[model samples]
Target: MSSIVEIKLSADQTEGTKATVAQWLKRKGEHVTINEPIIELETDKVMMEVIAPVSGVLEDIFVREGEPAEENIILGTILETAMSNPSNEQKNDREIRAEETPKNVSNDLPRKNPAAGQPDPPSTFISPAVRRLRQQHQFDLSQITGTGKNNRITTRDVNAYLSGSMDQSAAQNATYDAAAISPTAAGSEIIPHSQMRKIIADHMQHSVQTAPHVTSIFDLDLSAIIKHRKSNKQAFAQQGAKLTFTAYFMAAAIQAIKHQPKINSQFHEHGLEVFKHVNLGFGTALGDEGLIVPVIQQCQNLNLIQIAQELTRLTDKARNNQLTQKEVQGGTFTLSNHGVSGSLVATPIIINQPQSAILGLGKMEKRVVVEEHNGQDMMVIKPMCYVSLTIDHRALDAYQTNDFLSHFKAVIENWQ
Candidate 1:
């Protein structure tokens, strides 16, 4: 008698995610061991590997690469039938064929032609991020050497290739016309959505529908923090911490959250759910892949140096597509530093769902501002930036938004 073992996607992992089969590690006739990874599934939030549930031959594949796979769906099957009896299991044609000839009997695994005795060449494993990089750079995968596990190509290998040997002009001019695979109408191409892009669309739309959003903008003079950073950055560097403006921004945000605890809250049907911990999330861009936020949990207890160090590590991991699941969850508030990209000001940065508000920082520039010295008004050139707070009006109001920004501004401007 043959027993069938089915491969299924985890309900907990794929419940609300858009998952697609990234690739299959084993072919239909290959012998698979228990708990061996046989496939890779890609989603908007993470990349996951689905392992073999039983030690058996891969009997069937129900889902192919690039197909949408839902939670609890059977992806494939492993046949656990024994090769000892061939004539007795006449009802099963596939099972009878397994023992038709004498072969390697440990698992009696099926292969195309055992008589020829030529083993299949080992295949190179390309990770999702590495594949994306290759497509973006329009380079042949053969050009780069793999230095990863089992000779898999890592992101670092691709980066080294681009930096050391690849031509800048060639990379610049290399462009893939996604329109070739896209649907066209009247000379317009409808590009298909990637898993990440699809998730972003659904999430943003849900946030807009769920929250009544309101925004308030504040003008901030960053002179104090700038002077503080200039004097302390070298010392911070000695301690292996990079003192960027983001560290100061996060420090000030912590103070603001302390002042208005309601801002660090979530909207609920019964009432507002306020949180005691300040879990901070900052947006990091992943080229054209879209934005990912890596969070620092229990941030209220972290000092400025610790905050900067965590920021550095998380941002680096996020950009490299190496952030783990825990690193992206548990965000009580978010900070979108759009200023780093050269924007002067931005309005109503969308609130990350379940978080009451998000803060936006615009590009810092040297601007002339009026100041009072000895009770006399005078104009001075100072580094200035526009800070905006976007809140979910259902859980908060303009008063809280402005109050939070006011407290945040005070912290930044009056740094000791």
Candidate 2:
């Protein structure tokens, strides 16, 4: 008698909620040992490979590639059946016959099989973002070549291919006679949105429809902070860190929120609901598709080093399709660092639902300005950045919104 060992999903170290099965390494009837990598789970935080717990033959897979799975859910089963006993199993006759066939028997088989003796080579032909986009748009990718690392197709290539194909198809359709063209399009496609994308669209539409958004701008002088960062960035990198301006802004925003708690609040049916903890969500740009705001919880309590580490980890996970549902959830406030992309300023960023305001930081630039120092007016060069805070006017007045930005500016100017 053979016992079955189930392979279950596990959550990441952070407060992440769900993961998607990125890829599977082994097929049914393949023998695997304990701790062997069987599947890769793309959580909101990182891509984690779920290893086998006990040696057995992989029997059943409960999930497919690109499917969103909940945390702690069962992914597959490892049966205690021996590799030699291929005839006695639950698989259908076709599956059994296919399994019995030699690896080189497949019609699509190349002359030399690179995956014959070694473990399955990674399917690096398409990047994750591109694959997700293709799946979303129902675009067939038999003709596109990936330009990413290792010849992997990127999201941009897929998008461009889609656009070009659509234009060509539309032109070809117009040349056809009305009698030839069916009343209902024959080759049209109907693609469904992913769970993550649907949620994002719903929230974005709600925020735009419900909130009377207002944006207030302020300029900050970062001469002092720039010098401080220039001096400390080398030391920070020595500690295994990428010392971007985000860490500094996050620290400053925490101080500002502590001074004015009303900005870090939500609007409910009753009235304004203010939060005590400063849970800041960083609006990370994921390639060319869209943005995802992965939260950094308890910003007030964490030190600079800790903030940098978490930011690096979460952002990397977000880019690499590793974020969990929890990592993308529960944000009290949000920071949109549009400055990194060379934009000078942006106004009225759509609010993340349950949060009342979002802060936008524009590009940092050096400009000449006259200032009175010790009763003398002198032209001086200063690094300046524009900060725009978009608020829900239904819950907040303009005065309160402006005051919040003012406090934030003061924090940056007086950074230690």
Candidate 3:
């Protein structure tokens, strides 16, 4: 006799918090293999996939798209049965379509299921705005590529496809005219907050409200580090790792933390919780989608090259929306390197909570400075950047904060 099994969101998958139903990977009655992903759950920090517990047919869905789901929530059910092989005709059709599809199309785009002999249903996760746009343009969801989390379609993706299909000059003219129109004259848009955005907003507000923030800024001379990287960057690149300034900064931070262990600590109700190891979290901006911090655990033990490799891997995963939950959690210290986008400095960068302090690195620029050379003052151009440490005043005093920055500056300035 066939048995039905409940498919629930694993408690450990989301750290016991609520998540939004991002998408359903399989439709009802769809055959699924053991451990195959059946649904996606979008939490504040990362997108998590809920996989099937056993090989079976997806029998029913208990949760709808975009709805809040608690930990261990029964999202669906599966009817246990032996997997069936696809017919030759269905398999041939899928292969033909795969060959015909453009190379530029996302591999995650929904296609005909070989076993079912039918195109996968459009995700019920489509936003109202996207649905309206799709209907207005008479475009099928499968025809447009999704660039959002988990390859979910966004309104911008549809608009880009439509713009590409139009004449170049006409598209440019339309974009110009749209920008020229004021929101008051042409109806302002009211976009509902995305789940991720809402969570970020709440978290930021809570952090600001909870902590008495104090910021200390220092300027660092990066001449030695810059020269060192310039000399060895090519050698590092040949080994498949791109040596970046952030890596050097991360290494410097680790060294600084080693000198002052209190910097790599968190605030607790009874007392300060000084961590023995550094779980470094670096901020990665995702444009309008806001930022994510993917942590490099036990960073205290990693060398410069290893730090660079981890930074590159995490940044790539962040941009590609491929980061996991654990990759973003358990951070004891946070760093925000906003300089890459050309911002000179940002003071009082809010601390990522529980962590007592957060570091911010600003733009690196060449500046003329007077320095003693052979007992004579000489003017020379040096690479300089601004760094800030925003600390929770309740947990850290100016002495500890300033000492941390001093150690960090010393490490950067004197790098060999």
Candidate 4:
């Protein structure tokens, strides 16, 4: 006997809670091992893969790729007895081989009611115009059957569906009264949030609602780091990589975190949790889908070159939809590099949750500033960047935050 396992959306979609099926890793009838990644879902903030809960042969898929699953409703099913069900196996295999399969099959004619029992009452005939209106409301046509001449659905049917104008005269008064209530009309446009965005939103909101935010800023002279990278760019390229200032900054940030362990502390309901290891999260922008902060664990242990190489690989994976859930989940601290897009500075970046602080880097620009060298004031131009740290005030004070930034600045400015 095949047991139907419904894969429900996890309730922890914190960013915006809107989810869409990005891809199905396992096709119907494919054998999936226990805990194997079976599907990739795109939320507002990031892409997340849902793993199989138990070992099973996937028998059927209720949802197809690129479809809306915004309600976090039941997306699909996994059958435990698929291997034994040879009939289902053959049917799905043929479907997979069919080259004419549509990207979205629901747009086809409404499916016939299942033979199991009474189906929902058919809808009235709707005109093309009315069908368009229903699409705008995210309602499907199959849910409403046609009732006009020759059983054609008309515009009037759609209008009645939307405006509570449908006939209830001695036939279906209860259905009319019940259909009058419109969820969206009550004042919420239900745009689904992507999984990544949902998680980001939840963490950000929790950080804001739970902690008092405080920020500290410092400007660092990046001349030395820039020169070093410029000199070693070719050597890095020899290893099939591009050297970026982020690697240097990340290395420095790790050192600063080691020196000032307080900045890495997390605030909890009971008290505070301090992490001994420096697992850093780098915020990588993924265009319209928003950002994903893939964590590079044990940053304090990796040297600058290693950091650059790892960041390059992780970010490339992030853009090409290749990150695992664990790759994104844990971080002791976070760094957002707005400088990549030429931002000179930013303040009060929302801290990633369970962690106390995040560091923001601005564009490196050449600036002329008065320098006191051996008691003589001399004006000189140097490559400089503005760095800001946003910390949870409940866990860290301005003085501590400032001190951490100051040490980070010193590390960057004096880099050899």
Collision count for each candidate, in order: 0, 11, 0, 29
The per-residue C-alpha lDDT of model 2 at residue 45 equals 34
Residues 54-76 of candidate 1 have per-residue lDDT tens digits of 77678899999889888888999
Number of the predicted model whose lDDT against the real structure is largest: 3
Ranking by lDDT: 3, 1, 2, 4
Q: Write the per-residue lDDT of candidate 2 for residues 232-300, one digit (tens) a residue.
A: 888878786667789888888887888888889989998899998888998888653456788898778
Return whichever of 1 and 2 wins on TM-score. Answer: 1
Each prediction's TM-score against the native? 0.74, 0.60, 0.74, 0.66
Q: Measured by TM-score, how close is model 3 to the native structure?
A: 0.74
Which window of ten consecutive residues has the lowest lDDT sum in model 2?
Answer: 119-128
How far residue 79's Cα lies from its native spot in candidate 1, in Å, is 5.2
Q: After superposition, how far is residue 210 of candidate 1 from its true place, in Å?
A: 2.3
Residue pairs clashing, model 1: none
Model 4, C-alpha of 251: deviation from truth (Å) = 0.3
Which residue pairs does candidate 3 place in steric collision? none
